[model samples]
Target: MVKVKNLTDKEYLYGHKACPGCGLGTIGRLALKILGERTIVALPASCMSTVTTQYPQMNYSVPSLTMAFAGTGAVLTGMSAGLKAQGITDVHVLGLAGDGGTADIGLQALSGAVERGDDFIYICYDNEAYMNTGVQRSSLTPIGANTTNSPSGTASYGEKKPKKNLFEIMIAHRIPYAATASSAYPYDFMNKMEKAKSIRGPRFIHIMCPCPTGWGFASDLTVEIGKLAVETGMWYLAEYENGKVRMNVISKTLKPVEEYLIKQRRFRHLTEDTIKLIREHRDSEWRIIRERWVLSKC
Candidate 1:
């Protein structure tokens, strides 16, 4: 068994409200481990909100503000501003949400937060669909993937659009730091989290989390499925700073995209043509990201 490194944070102890194998919960547990007691969390309505704010009590070790489904960035920005006005700069503020909360409904507040260079580390744990709300398709959902709203049948080509390019959107804001990570690898994920907080301006972290409930995979396969996402180039590990692109993993020998697809029942309806189409789209997108965009150290 892989032993995850320990964290100094001691807030999380016994009781918590995450479903068994809830990837988001693991992410929160790990993140707060580094963010520690000195941090405050601003969360939008998502799986995290549900888990942390489970009816009888809550799970956040530090102070937290639960904002509307799409207002985490705005709320966090305002909170940070209020704290700044009060000369409370020692506490680190973090705004976090799901992919639906980040890529779609919450984009406006998120964009504004980044553009204004709010002093917070905003994270989106991208489960790709709105899992807490009946597994509907979100802008972050992969093309050709079936969601409750995009089920395969006589209608539509199954989420007709590509996954929204959130990284590009963050880049457009010229934010100080932004990176994409995977939950299956905590070392890389936590390292990025720590690094992002060190910067003075806004920082964005987009983490891919596998959802067994929504993705139609067995819960036990969460880690393996997440790993397959990277091995197949379906999801990649990338980072950006000072306006340049740096990809962390581009497998020398890519695991077939088909292996990754067949694991999830969501893509089970695929015919050979649909599979080919999906791979073609995936590669085309990868081609653009494969280039190393230079950054100015200024």
Candidate 2:
């Protein structure tokens, strides 16, 4: 078991609007804690923006900038440049966005920033779909997940496509650091964020945050669901550095996918065939990841 230190006195403050058991809030807290007070957070239009910056009071202890849904990466690049011009080399720039903002609408700006090799860290807290926008389906929504847009009725299955290979996308950009993280493993998440802070180029962390309202799970199952995701190999914990890939020790041994699927109501109405399809997809992806790990050893 990985013992994570308590960060109750960190950057995240009390009195926020996030739903009970929302992992996005946990992600924000842990990430900010690791990035430290000198960090400037850039949030695109997402759940974090709404909950963290409610009128009259803000939950974030550090400075935060709210931007358009597709402007996070671009704005962060500018912020980093501005800080550099002002001779503020010690401050870190952190960009926070949802799956919709990062994988879909914000992909262009993010790509541009990464291609330019901006000095900042972009963290995408993916709750699977556009949870902040009525639980709509986003490209990152996993196959067989029943979102409002991808309803699993007799006429059609849930999401037709598999979750976007976001990690690979980031790696393809040749960023200095890229990793997968989850609120279930706070220590690993914090360690990755801290590592990204130490690096001087563009870094990316894709966090699989669980949403109680969107996934139709009990509000308290956020952490449990996140754990199940890692245990089942649905969400792997891995990092890419210096042209090599390394899987986290805990995620090497995976449990059955069913154990993770059955816990979320989004997959409750899935047919046996759909479950098999999901398993096949998960296994195939795992195989590819294993192959990459092997290559990294060469």
Q: CA lDDT of each candidate?
A: 0.82, 0.87
**Candidate 2 residues 1-298, lDDT tens each?**
1235445365554567999989987788777777678889899999889888988988877888888999998998999999989989999899999999999999999999999998999999999998887899999999999989899999988899999989999989878999999988888888898788889989999999999999988997888999898878788788999988787846446788888899889999988899899999989998887776842210
TM-scores for the candidates: 0.93, 0.94
Cα RMSDs of all predictions? 3.2, 2.5
Candidate 2 runs further than 4 Å off:
1-8, 249-253, 294-298
Query: With candidate 2 superimposed using the best TM-score fit, by how many Å does residue 76's alpha carbon deviate from the native?
Result: 0.5
Instruction: Estimate, for each residue in 233-258, the C-alpha lDDT of model 1 and write its tens digit.
Output: 78877778877877777456678789
Local lDDT at 245 for model 2: 78
Q: Superposing every Cα of model 1 onto the true structure, what RMSD results?
A: 3.2
- Spell out the clash pairs found in candidate 2: none
Name the candidate that leads on TM-score.
Answer: 2
